[model samples]
Target: MLATLLGLDHLVIAVRDLDAAAAEWRALGFTVSPRGLHSPHIGSANHTMMFGEDYLELLGVVAPQPHNEALRAFLSAREGLERAAFTTTDAAAGVAALRARGLAATGPVDFSRPVPLPDGGGAEARFTVFHFPREEAPAGLRVFACQHHTRDAVWVPTLQSHPNGVTRILSALVATEDPAGAAAHLARLIEGTARRDGAFHRVATGPGRADIAFAPRAAIAALARCAEEALPLEGGAGMVLPTRKPRPPALASGTAIIFEEAA
Candidate 1:
């Protein structure tokens, strides 16, 4: 198992139309960041909804490039929750720890994107990402560790206030055929303990304290109000958001997001 301490970073939602997706999120009462273009080499763009330390990223492919072929394919197949990233202070150490556990990691690759600041200026947000081998990652899930070089540039207080009354992310729900097996794998990756709760297995990482639950296929389908086949095999099926009062689950680009009353 990896030894690095990981915390929830952000969730990615892939969309076909960036403008429409942003507008939809706004209508749902979220404050979204201005569109940010990835480095010219990456061929992608994103708009983010900031919520304290963790946020939601709406990703779209603006240009086709070999480097972003995987993202392009994900968009072509369907649009919804595509990836979940965790935070690490030292990405190199995190990769080393994963490698020590016999898990293949690609790199602590450094990248940056220009983000439009609320004050009408541009600031560069830098990041280093450590990726796991597709085969070793959780089934139907794309997970990675991210180390931010410029935190202030990404999480501005002015952009975090949302009209939907959401304060923070609580959990990401994953539907899988084998909840126990999936939970075990995620526990190892996050270096956390997994416990069974009925048909769901919950793994809680430190600091962020957000739960990642692996639920039985039927249970998740019921929660999402959709057919089981409509959900991703092992991908994020829904998200739990903390709100002042209970709000019904909302569907965005095929992903179900539940808003629960904050404790």
Candidate 2:
């Protein structure tokens, strides 16, 4: 079969403080990768927590540039689940598919970051990405598709093990004015289907991938109370929640997280 939308690839949290964010996730028991620097054109840096089939990225703008203009604005408003990327085997094909469906998907933009290897070496983790129209996605949230060219440089086994035993992102909870509309838009972007259940609209990415639920703020805020804590953009942890700074839907801004444990 030709390339298809794989599933939820990773969740992105934009933080004003990358080092502090990295330290926080590490304290939460995740083995985050060393900071990866993007090309000058992008002017961003990140650290990632690798999982079996997905990961979570903490991104920050280290320099001002045209490419990260939207991201900078996101950080200004709040720092929390800003974007979610879908995995694709072929980025060009994925963009084509989205266009075929009448969505104005853009890019097969390629970039790379240097990764410091455990064995005192380094490798470049390269990627190609296509973005769904910003106006089409929920306000303050970005959705896109990604294709990885250097899996080994990324999905490093050592980085996949977390002390908390959290395995992967289970779901994302988004609070929006129109749950069904938001959920349907995201489902279409990921090549999934959405179903409405009362105040929530749920989008399941695929088998063994993250699910997204769109709901009203009150409905999502109720779930947040059960969590140990929530950060606007830093709400990713599993099994054992963070030792400090927790989430509630309001704190998570537009999206809250639901994690899984299999340590």
Runs in model 2 lying further than 4 Å from the true structure: 1-3, 226-263
1-263 per-residue lDDT for model 2 (tens digits): 11467788888888888898888778656788999999888899999989889888889999999889989987787777778788888999878887887888889899999999999899999999989887766534578888999999999988988776667776666666677777776765665789987887778877788776777666655565543334332222111122123332223223344333233
**What C-alpha lDDT does candidate 2 achieve relative to the native structure?**
0.72
Candidate 2, residue 233: Cα displacement in angstroms equals 13
The lDDT, on a scale of 0 to 1, for candidate 1 is 0.82
Each candidate's root-mean-square deviation in Å?
1.8, 4.6
| Model 1 clashing-pair count | 0
Residue 163 lDDT in candidate 1? 88
Which candidate has the highest TM-score of all?
Answer: 1
lDDT of 1 by residue, 1-263 (tens): 24555577888888999999999888888898999888877788999998877889999998898767877888788888877888878889988888887888878788889988778888999988887766655646678888998999999888899988887888888878898998898887777789998988888766655778888767877876777777777667778899886677788876888888898
